[model samples]
Target: MTDGEGWFVVNACESRWRDDGTLGSYCTFEGKRRFPHFGININVLGPGEALGMYHRENAQEAFLVLAGECTLIVEGKRRPLATWDFFYCAPGTEHVIVATSEQNAIVLAVGARGRGVGGGVVYRVSKEAARHGASVERETTSSAEAYAEAHADLPRSRWVPYREGWLPSDR
Candidate 1:
């Protein structure tokens, strides 16, 4: 647990969101810093905000709710999630998470990475998600096409105080 050449560290509180400000991520470690093997992001979703278009990917993904609440729409089913809840999606398991709580929700997400992993993400339609205008009607591997009508810039996450003593130790 070090923040050296190979290891990285940053407090979620200090992380800046994308320009859009709908969601924020501690993605520097995995995106710009180029941490390899697997990728990790601390995602913050604002109230009523959808994670993304309803979609499934070739790579396996897991999420841990660190604060607030959300609804997990997976395979057309709605699952409510609260703090400390964990969700895992196998490759091709269509899913999306939408913040339903009044306050913004924080989720720690990790995904497998490597050759032969993450074929791509395909957006799909879901009646449950459609109720919130978060689903797509056609299948498409093009994220650009799926999000063509969306805000051009990616939004950043909002800052919030972490639960006391919940931050992981660097050791």
Candidate 2:
């Protein structure tokens, strides 16, 4: 579909979205102009190239694999994703995505852009935990814990315990 107004076809060879070795294109309708609800991007992850696990403060993301194979590491569980596979990373969920095969895999990623307010918020743990490389851990009750403590009255508390279903490795 080609329209002279309010529509644009972004060439895949040139895209503004950061690429972690992923070949793809995006059609930004209202882009940043839409603020919280932006357009969408199609990503083609090359072999051995996987997106690192990270979380946004407020964006809720979802991905659909159009071709090839890949792995989705949401929260902490790794799930194989082939063509026609869809994955969702709701707001506050710490997650990562990786390409599993030698061939490139195409994936469509969409999400809302906004400030995050929830549990999965990353926080600095104890010196021991930090020293031992405990990395991101469940909040127990510490001065630092107060920093990344999931926001008060989060609507998804009941699901926090089962966050492992998404992440590659649940802490």
Candidate 3:
């Protein structure tokens, strides 16, 4: 939906998840068509699911937990996160998010984008991430090399509507 003056608006329910079940699910906003300075996406993770390999990128990235709970593995440290928690990863901060709650978790992610913002990402091995099956055994600058063994298809998954006032339990 256009905002009439270049701004675009879209509900998460309108976007389908990509490559679901293999790890986590994500609905990437059409930033290329609307916003040019940044990228945005909504990530959904089920219990024990990882967001992908532990990696760091040249562009700064941030996340806001919209629902449920998850574990943030960053720089070899583990941080438990719940709904409404926000996380910021400066450029080159190795990290990955894994769902720890019984229910699915949703995260709103944003990242810097523009000229000179290299899209380079390097995968790293982290003991904390290894337990979640997100760690790479070796350092690699190529995503192809980092995920060469992955076989998940890139088809879009069915979209699920978010429930109103859904908050994670205080467990």
RMSD of each: 4.9, 13.3, 4.6
Model 3 agreement with the true structure over 24-93: per-residue lDDT tens digits: 6677655325456787777777888877789998889999999889999998899999999999999989
Winner by lDDT between candidate 3 and candidate 2? 3
Model 2 segments more than 4 A misplaced: 1-5, 9-36, 116-171
**Residue 123 lDDT, candidate 2, scale 0-100:** 36
Model 3, residue 59: distance off in Å is 1.3
The stretch of ten residues in a row with the least summed lDDT in candidate 1 is 162-171
Misplaced by over 4 Å in model 3 are: 1-5, 31-34, 115-118, 152-171
Estimate every model's Cα lDDT from 0 to 1: 0.69, 0.49, 0.75
TM-score for model 3? 0.79
Whole-structure CA lDDT of model 1 = 0.69
Point to the candidate with the largest lDDT.
3
Q: Best candidate per TM-score, number?
A: 3
Question: Candidate 2 has what TM-score?
Answer: 0.53
How close is every model to the real structure, measured as TM-score? Answer: 0.76, 0.53, 0.79
Give the range of the ten consecutive residues with the poorest summed lDDT in model 2. 157-166
Residue 18 shift from truth in candidate 2, angstroms: 5.6
Cα error of candidate 3 at position 105, Å: 0.6
